[model samples]
Target: MTFAGSLNPSFYQSLWQDCDSIYMQHQSNCLTLQDNYQVNVNLLLLAIWLDSHHQLLDSSNWQQLQQILLQWEQKLLLPYRKLRRLSKAALEQAEYQQMLDVELMLERKSQAKILRNLKSMALNEVSSTEPESNIGRYLTLFNLDSQDYPNLGQ
Candidate 1:
């Protein structure tokens, strides 16, 4: 179905910021997903946002979204995130903060790209027969359990 209008990127940014707060509150689990599983937290938040809006991506759309996020994660976010983490010990406080600001800027760019793609796509409406949550579907691709993570949408 067609979107009525373009989604505001700030809305997604707000969702991510709220989820990021939760991640900070529950750092260990988030760190595990980040460090061990390499889960992209922003993508998870996007899944939750889409589910909240009753939007469903067909398999092809879902795969394309994954590919987009994977490109951002692999080529940009991950390396910068790793550098940020590593720099915490090696760099001075001010310099590390600058790195963090830059990382956040990159994250905003990534989110905008995702939202732009979403705006251009034809998404399916969530059907009664599809009882699974979007976040659950997304996590399933990585063999993850929704119960293992904080509930951000509900």
Candidate 2:
């Protein structure tokens, strides 16, 4: 059997139709759940939203979406009060650790100064000489000697 003579839609029209179908399906499911005592407004809205969008999203294999939305709603609504308490606890712990780090760094700096002083004292007891009889290699890499060069000490 041959199927023929159906109109061809533009790319955007086809895309819109697919989107509309998903939305309709989600709305239908959400409305059905409204009659049940177990579904809240938040849950119904979340379900409808997820039903339409989850196919285009990723990788909890789509299983955790409901739990994730619930958690997100909780976080959004009561975050400052709850999270502030948590952050205050974390800050105190961090401050104690920071004090320990500061103490350790001060000790290390003191030790480093003692070691550097000992090193300078040892160097003061030794003698060194400049190389007076050797010639060094020269290069023409940048034609540096082609003109006057700036003083390197700067």
Q: Which one is best on lDDT? A: 1
Native-to-model Cα distance after best TM-score fit, residue 110 in candidate 2, in Å: 55
Which 10-residue span in candidate 2 carries the lowest summed lDDT?
131-140
Off by over 4 Å in 2: 1-21, 34-60, 75-154
lDDT of each: 0.70, 0.31
Deviation of model 1 at 93, angstroms: 1.4
Q: Report clash pairs, candidate 1.
A: none
Displacement of residue 64 (Cα, Å) in model 2 is 1.7
Give a tens-digit lDDT track for model 1, residues 8-80. Answer: 5564456666656655655565567667776666666667667766877655565677788887678888888
Checking candidate 2 for backbone clashes, the offending pairs are none
Candidate 1 regions with alpha-carbon error over 4 angstroms = 3-31, 127-130
